[model samples]
Target: MEENLRNNLIDKLQNNTISSEEREELFKLYNSYQFSKEWNENTMGNFEDVRKKILKGVKLKRNGASRGKIYAINSFLRIAAACLLVFFTGWLGYTLILKPDPNVIVESGKSRKEVVLPDGSKITMNINSTLTYPRVFEAKRREVKFEGEGFFEIQADRSHPFIVATPHVKVRVLGTAFNLKAYKEDPAIETSLIHGKVEVLTAKEERTLSILTPNHKFVVDKIALITSHLPQTKSQIEVVPMEFIDPSNTAPVDLAWKEGKFAFASSPFQDIAREMKRRYAVDIIFENKEAADFKYTASFEQEDVVDILDALQLVKPFKYRKEGNKIVVY
Candidate 1:
């Protein structure tokens, strides 16, 4: 009776006419067999061996059959072949299709790019940033790897939490909008939460460093953490409060790039030069080291490289000259 029921369930499944209850029963049976030690040990071998064994059994049966019995025997062989084909196909599908290569990489170079993930989450990637994500999310979570800078607006899926991984840190959120800056060349990794909540973890140890709420910013010095071993002292990671108090009410300083605006609050000249190169596709060379160390507070909306440089000159005395694709600063 049990064998008959199992065969019937498989038939229903193959024919695509299985009821929900019957499907559940079939799944239970599949799970039981899938977890068995014998199944694991046997299923690892090549499928061709199983096919050869089935053919051998059919050949032995054909030789033993009489002329009158041959017609019945042939019919039985046909059914047996069909059943074997279905069983092997199902087994292969279960073993192979369950764990596919999930990594799908998206990168932006020389220009900013926007990406929409499988789960409706959106990422506005800065120039030279790369994002690696699964083609399809796993059962319990949605995760992605990110390099450089990106502003993320994640969809609300509390059951399947979203995670973004960088070289230095991992940010996990159920649903949130945030900006992440984690350039390999940069000394620090920064996460500024616009809304909702996010938990930050260290990449090497998977230790929960901080949990951020709306209007909070988290910064970690990569060099400090790597060079020092002061567990009793203050951690290299720091959390600070940020306000959205721009006169135009556009966005926070960290997230202003998403609006095609370059806004900086006392940012170093070298850092500004790096951002300028990414935004304008031009190389900036500081002739003087003192010029690179200068910090400036400024904002520009769709300004040309020459115009921005001119504006900077008015605030702080600096000489700049453009030659071909390169700008020399002193």
Candidate 2:
């Protein structure tokens, strides 16, 4: 083979791409290369290591695998990572299931919705999230109740702190973008900050005062008066001081729902049903107990309940039927 052929082969091999014949040709060429043995020792390794490294590094974009075989290495690692990406149907699912706001966001279902509020935090409820709030608020004390969830970029008026109160806890924020999860049956209340500061208060006690900067988060236990705060700063710029919630590291994932999508994080079936009912304008009732425990972690956009049920069946097999306006999950 010519030098150019060798170079091209090297490129493909490095990128984990080769046809059956190409693989055989590459094996012969790679061995013939100068110091090729050393190169192999240094570059190539078991597939698992490669896959973990790749998956951990770049989150491939959705829109099907047009990623070519570029920058890939032929190893079990590539196979595993590619399998995961393919299994999920793509990498980055911009189109997500507009899940119920964990805090209190009323979602419009297959119909138009208008959400009036106490402090004039007017939110236009989209299909699928049942949101409830007080008609008003008082000073040194601000509370609005909600179920499901919503993506909020609060209108800042620092004097009256905006608190999205649920039965379990409250997510308080002033002038910032974030997503909250306070479903009725969830074991914990999760608040993720996309920008700005927020505090989660329980038992009306603000001790240690879980203060969260951007990208940082504070999750409160539903029953227990405890709080959990994860590290938010970057690992590389440790010396440099900056605050932002790393969407790449938080769970219940990012909030692309308001933009019309559903984003779940291994959430319970019941919670998922509640979100669907609000968004699709259809009711999701559990017909079977076994299905309720089924957990899911995926995203979609304006998907019907059948698709949702199909996804649920992936984790926990069950039966179901439709009852007029409701989905009976058995």
Candidate 3:
């Protein structure tokens, strides 16, 4: 009677009309084969190899037995392949569902992008900059991550502190306007507070470097601290306090981007080139090291890259040429 039942199931599987009850029975048989001592003793290999081994083993066991047993073994092989296909399909579906999507992302390529956060805070991202935040602000505090440069105008919310996190440092503020510059390739991280108050801290140790006030810029020389032989402590890190250029001016130098202008005061030529690169999305190469070492105090309003470079030349005797997307200075 068992032989007749097995033969009927095998016929149904071969004809592609196997019933649900027959599939359950086949699963039980497959499980038994999987946990058997013979299966465990066999060295594990690829799925194909394992399937072949199982088929070979079943055939050998029923050799010279009866035709019904041989048919049952073939039926098991078909079911095993179907089970493997289903397993992979289910796994692929699970992975797709679990993948995460960026809740809020702002990217500025050759131009700037203005983003308003959920808490009514506004951020103006500079060229080649990126800012990411969650879809909703957390109950306790509002947090966001940033790369490159951004000017933030945060709404007043003393109850919930707003935090901006970067690779090198973190800035915490209740309600204030500030500018943060933290590029991965840059050697320093700069935070300039325009109004209200903010606290800057190192990312690694969460050590508060300084509490900044309006019109003050805080600079952390990361390379100098890392290479220095001094004791590696929060106290040893070099934090420079520099005053914004022309406080009497309507907009401080740090906030010049908001007015479509670039301002600098006694800034190194190399540093100017870096700022030009960020603003124009073009490369500024210095062919002469001496030219790069010069310092200039200047500002440009709504000027193109060539115009800015020409203005710099008026202050200092230097030559520049444009080659495609790069400006070569000598």
Candidate 4:
């Protein structure tokens, strides 16, 4: 009799004809009874579709329901669905629904995205970047994991330091504005300070690589850090003055990308190609090693990929042929 009543309630719910009393009864029945193996096998094939229909049907039927009743029913149904998923889908549902990570932020394709952290710090993420941080920062320090590139304007908090961890180096700052470039494929990790102070540290925080000031850049060579054998006392970081778009204006080239500008300062041809690939969502193929190693210094705004390539050709002779979304340069 209980099994028949439960099946009847489920059928009513699926058909969008379940009454308020029936919904309440169904909620209680779901808690008490385990679903049959045959029913689970049949429903598993269209789980997502069934889940969507169930929620949509409930929402449509709740037009005249009281707020308190609606809340109770909605909460119960969500839990019931989760229970069903746990039994039917096994670990996939448990990981995605129950033990989900709430703050793994990702930006894909060729557009930049701005994210405001819990402490009111703003991060402008470049194309193809990921940043992970807790929903609420810890009491001692505000820490985040980052890769690709981003422009950070951190909120000032002397008590709680802001830390950014990348593959090669860890950056610690009290409160500072800086641009970090740490693409996994790139040979070096770069931190360009715009204002305030920041300390670049080794992977384990054992050594201070460099302390950056305004208009300065700190670079870490990944190959050198990996291949070195001796106990070196000197810092392995290269500190350089930030590249300017023009000497007269005093505007640093590093911050240009956030403003929709593509700037490079005597950057290798391959690096330029990589930047273009991210900005334009295209692939660049080098036919010759010499072409790939050619150094170029230029800044561009409001130009298409082909136009930029044409401009580069004027500076140095190179032949390139377009093949769909890719450009092959020789």
Candidate 5:
């Protein structure tokens, strides 16, 4: 093909009017350039290089080749493959590389997310939750921190124990399934043991270390002189047996959010509202503080946001309205 004729065909091919003959010619050009890496050079520094290469194929100007005769294609697979390989291997003479590390994931919102750690320990994260962890296991010890709420089921290891650190308290578990609730505003931290045992350590000097047994719960309770003095606000670690038809049900509930369910395992009204904020990406405010303690005992059939809210309103007495994507309290 003459240079002028080839340029006309290449332009037509790029414009979607390519005929069978032109398609074959384009493929030939692509293959020729692919094998001829001597002229390709190294343009792997920026991701945009591959982008442009895909939109515009590499074309050489020979003695008689038309200046406008350039091969182009939308597919940039070859460029992507070459650039990715070079970038990851640092062959482009660059010192730094962009590598993503491992993460700790937590879930909670009108629901919870339960995660098993690298060492076989479990974490039940509560609504719109997140957890950060190292990609590889460290030989010394496994450590994780939580923001909102979660339950952990840790595989027991005598030599390497599991440790969970919140802002003020640290709970080390040998091998156990325990619930940890640490809301930022709330003063108390609750660690509910579902199985096995753990040691709860606090920052305060007055309280000694407490050994939490299965079914016994741990809470850091604080109190001030309020309406009644019987117990102003007792924040201490205590154990209470967890009711179970089959206690393992906690895992499904903890993990339901990842599968897209705004779950509520008998969570309170305000607690559920906090979850609504996270799951629905809305703001929830309470007009009354007394509404905070309203307990709910029903499990919801996993459904859409509107359906869940309607069901909750009927099951519990509360008025709510939707403002844009947000649900506000009157």
Candidate 6:
């Protein structure tokens, strides 16, 4: 596209006068520019150049102004610097604000990430999770694809219902705060609501499985559904109250991981080990089959993996040893 045409299209977008065809043309241009060699080579250098100019301006004006005046001047300079930085950073601002393609965010190893959507909804992703969302939602609905686990604080839009699609289930809500765990290796998919209401639905059929209220959880038994040989019609699901370690404080066990705390209630040893493997970036091997099926409840905050293993042994009397990079339990 020509520079004049690009500027004209951008002006139309800013004034909310761009037709659908023009928007499509702008998106195609952005997509082409994103993959060009110029974008790859010049982005970082342009950012550095803009940063230096902003810093030079700040230092030059600091000595000439009063304290109050300097504060105001610095604030104005910051805003100007941001505008200049965005202008020179190629089409990044435009892509983030106007692109039609979905954006994928992945959190791997032991790290967590916080993502804010275009509509101001917040998502805090757990380790080994992936979320895919568009830069902007459609006029009629807001939707995203998710896997693993995430804590969502959705922005309320009654006209456009927010939907989260996982492999096994879907969660629909108007505006709510909730934690959804749908790890592939886990036995079940758990959706725990903190506040507001949500409708849980079947992924394949889009059938309503359950409606959840605050301090409640909806669970889908994935293992049972997968293993059953007969023609399965209804999914084995359960609705239960959220677990609280202390009734006085009323903190849900589902949200403990967000606080850097691991809390489990009568969870299987193999399932706990899988979570530990992701959280600590270590492999756990079970030499004894009985140990893998052992049920235990435990909670720890900021403890080393070895310390947690040792603590668990004191209660259940299981033996485990570190063998190179893997922890072997017998």
* Residue pairs in candidate 1 whose N, alpha carbon or C atoms collide under 3 angstroms: none
**Estimated TM-score per prediction?**
0.65, 0.45, 0.65, 0.67, 0.52, 0.65
Query: How many steric clashes between backbone atoms does each model show?
Result: 0, 42, 0, 0, 22, 0
lDDT: which is higher, 3 or 5?
A: 3
Worst 10 contiguous positions by lDDT, candidate 3? 36-45
Which residue pairs clash in candidate 3? Answer: none
- Per-residue lDDT of 1-330 in model 1, one digit per residue for the tens? 755675676566555576666765655555565323333224223334433433444455446556549888888999999999999999899778975666878889867899999999999998889999989886698989999999999999989999898877789999999999999888888999999999987776447788998888998888765543466424777788763438765568888777778888777889899888878888999997898988888889978999888888888888988899999997
lDDT of 4 by residue, 252-289 (tens): 88888888899999888999998888788899999977
lDDT of every predicted structure (CA atoms):
0.80, 0.59, 0.76, 0.82, 0.60, 0.79
Model 5 error, position 155 (Å): 2.5
Write model 5 residue lDDT over 124-229, tens digit each, in one string: 6766455766666686777777767776778878888787777767788777777777777565566777678888765332333578876666656533212112
Weakest 10 consecutive residues of candidate 5 by summed lDDT: 222-231
Q: Model 1: what TM-score?
A: 0.65
Candidate 1, residue 229: CA error in Å?
A: 6.0
Model 4 regions more than 4 Å off:
1-104, 227-236
Cα lDDT over the full model 1: 0.80
List the candidate 2 regions with Cα displacement exceeding 4 Å. 1-148, 155-161, 183-188, 203-209, 216-221, 225-254, 281-288, 314-316, 323-330
TM-score of 2: 0.45
Q: Which sections of candidate 5 miss by over 4 Å?
A: 1-127, 134-140, 183-188, 203-209, 221-238, 243-267, 288-293
Q: Which candidate is the best by lDDT?
A: 4
Q: Quote model 5's TM-score.
A: 0.52
Prediction 6 global C-alpha lDDT: 0.79
